[model samples]
Target: MQVSGTFLAFAVLSLLTIGGAVFMISFTRVVHMVISLGVTFLSIAGLFVLLEAEFVAISQILVYSGAISILMLFGIMLTKHDAKDEGVSKANKGWLSILVVAVFFVIAFWGIQSTPWVAPPDNAAAVQEDNATQLGVEIFTRFVIPFELTSVLLLVALVGAIILAKKEEDNE
Candidate 1:
């Protein structure tokens, strides 16, 4: 029955996250969309911090807001997407997107309303305090191979992008 500062922070962060996503989807330019995506990523990081997951929040900022956004910008700058439109008109595309979004919203709203909410346990704070340690242990012990593989995959993608850009430069 009372409004807490944490709840207010959450409301603000959630609105920013949703607004950024909407802007990202609505933008026509690739650069604008990427910037909006960065904003969304940062807001989500804020939400994670609000939930007391500092390590995850920092990882989100560093990985998503910093590295991924920069990578996307580089990829966009390197690639040529100058092809003219040859498909549906903007008006039809807009209407179709609106319909799809409306359906998704309805489904999400129904799911949220139907779910039974429960309060957190008193020891949740104790569990959260060790989350970063637990996460590190799990990653190193159980998910180390997958984590290393993901890093390698990112390296490969970066190399591929550079090769493509070099090819484009050579052609030009």
Candidate 2:
């Protein structure tokens, strides 16, 4: 069997995505974690692009890597997260986390392996050609209210965060 460039690209992106997630979880600083999350988001967007979904990839980058990350950074900056030294040792917490992750991984692997995989339908290629256009049409026609409501909810959250931060500043 011959190795393909696409496979190599996918492997690199997958590693980056997993590495980012691991770093995000391992980092102690909130800002560092958020940056790692952005890396992970970008890697996911790369995966989307590799799958030929350029529009989805761009949206992923814009929404997750850009907006959501900035939102998280703003939230972190606005809040006071004073470190409180607790009873749990870092090593113990690390071991517990590892064990929990291992169990979850095992369960996920089992579930995926046990499931019956189905082949794509004959028209799958035809549908793939205009997925982005179809998605936009569906969202605007059928899901416009929900889409707009989501934007409203995000605005509300941003305002709430600002208000809470202001209240804290006043208290201080």
Candidate 3:
């Protein structure tokens, strides 16, 4: 009974996550898109919880929902178009989009359902016994360079956005 309930919860969250992602990408309003992205991040955190990855779940909520979403919202505000405006209509190929998305979803669902998953042997499972500690050690030791590089990349992106959004002064 409990297992079924958990399974149902996971399924619902998964759908919510996908829906949120679609809303984020499809909506023209930047604020609405950011809110939808928040929903997606929160749903992903819930999924991590359902998978028993408590540390990862907490980090997902903290980093993505807390930091990344706020950063995106700030970026939108900095762009000088914070107020909602019915801007020029772009090309809307609704039927083509629908067909493409439907085909992609069908193929993805079929692949996921058809795949066979096997659990590791009992002895090998010991590798996960202290997952949080092991994960921390690996991140700091083995993956430290990549982690630092990602931080640098984020910083560069922030600077680029700021430069792009700045207004040029007219020289008399």
Candidate 4:
């Protein structure tokens, strides 16, 4: 099979994304985990761009990479996390973990095999250029309330974090 530039890029990004997720789970530090999560989000965003979903790509970058990542980092900084507390986590349910992973693997494999994928049109010139514009307009008109609610949700989370981070007065 002839290898294409898009296929090569997709393969590299897929490896980076999987590696990031694995490293994120393996990291002991909360900050390292958040950064690794950002890597996975970034690679997914690149995948969206590759699929020609520009609006989704930009939204992924803004929401996942820009906002969610910063929020996580801020939350980590606010919490009293000690390096000595890192080893507190241990794998307690070995069989359950394996069972859950096996179930998900079977479901994903079945889904992939069952799905019918259509090949793209050979005439690339037939594609329209106003997809992003149409998506933006629809979002503003139809999904404006949900979009605003998401902002409100983020604000509420920030406030909750601040409340959690507040310390009691110390008696000397």
Candidate 5:
């Protein structure tokens, strides 16, 4: 019973997340788009919780919903004076795009449903567990170099944003 309830919850959240994403993309108003994005992030976090990844769920909420969404909202605010007037145009071929996407989804779903998934043998399972642990350890240690590089990239992006937002001395 509990498992079924969780599955239902996950399904509902997934639908909400997709709906929110669609709303975000379709809305003309920047504020409405931001709010829809927040809904999408929160729904995804709920999904992570349902998947038993508590740490990842919290991080998703903190990083995406809290920090990234706020950053995007701030960017929108700084870049545009009138929110409703900006990005008001919808795609001219939206119906065609939707039809193509639906056909692709149906084909992909049929292909996936036809697949046979097999569990690993005992020896393969042992190797898989060891490999997973080793991969995690390596990511935490040797891969720190790439991680630090990515942080530096983010810092550079922040600096660029500040430069762009700065008013000229004459304007000030």
Candidate 6:
């Protein structure tokens, strides 16, 4: 039997996403890791499209692949690091770190399995029409304070990053 296009697309995107994540973690160079992260974000955006979430897909592409990836690349460039350190950073206690991760995964898996999840009703068409307007209104009117505060927080972080990037001897 021939497989459906949607299922095939989903499988390809899923594999790509997982591969990207693995590459992102395994890559030693900061630039390579950031590029891998972009791959993951783009694949996830494709998955959102497959799920008929056009707004979410666009947001994922714009916010994650476009903005966040660029931000991460800039952050990497702004920070000082020795070019000779080509190897990926490793924890001193590798076994303990692995055990902690395993335990965390077990707890997360148990929580996921035990949770009662309710699937939203499939009214994609209805939601699609007003989603943008609703989202904008809520963000501006209801969540304006939080939104502005986040802007301030980002500004502070940017200033802090700039400050950190400066060499003390150069400053003098």
Steric overlap count per candidate: 0, 0, 0, 0, 0, 0
TM-scores for all predictions: 0.76, 0.77, 0.71, 0.74, 0.70, 0.72
lDDT of 2 by residue, 22-130 (tens): 8886777778888899999999999998988889999999999999999887777667564322334787897898799899999999999999999888987677777
* Model 4 Cα lDDT, one tens digit per residue, 1-172: 8999999999999998999999987898778888999999999999988888888989999999999999877767766554322543457676678788999999999999999988878786345356688777888999999999999998998899778777867837
* Candidate 6 colliding pairs: none
Q: Which scores higher on TM-score, 2 or 5?
A: 2
Model 6 residue 5 lDDT score: 93
Q: How many times do residue backbones clash in model 2?
A: 0
Per-residue lDDT over 1-172 for candidate 1, one digit per residue giving the tens place of the 0 to 100 score: 9999999999999999999998876777778888899989999999999988899999999999999999888878767453222334687887898899899999999999999999888987777777789889989999999999999998998899778657464454
- lDDT (0 to 1) per candidate: 0.87, 0.87, 0.86, 0.85, 0.83, 0.85
Residue-wise lDDT of candidate 5 within 1-172, one digit each (tens)?
Answer: 2568877897899999999999988898888899899999999999987765566788899999999899888888877845773442467676778789899999999999999978757675454344445756777899988988999999999999889878778864
After superposition, the stretches of candidate 5 with alpha carbons farther than 4 Å from their true spots are 1-3, 85-92, 119-138, 170-172
RMSD of 3: 3.7
Count steric clashes of candidate 6.
Answer: 0
Model 6 lDDT on a 0 to 1 scale: 0.85
Q: Name every residue pair that clashes in candidate 2.
A: none
Of 3 and 4, the candidate ahead on TM-score is 4
> Which parts of model 4 have CA positions greater than 4 angstroms off?
81-92, 119-128, 141-172
User: Rank by TM-score, descending?
Assistant: 2, 1, 4, 6, 3, 5
Model 1 bad stretches (over 4 Å): 79-90, 155-172
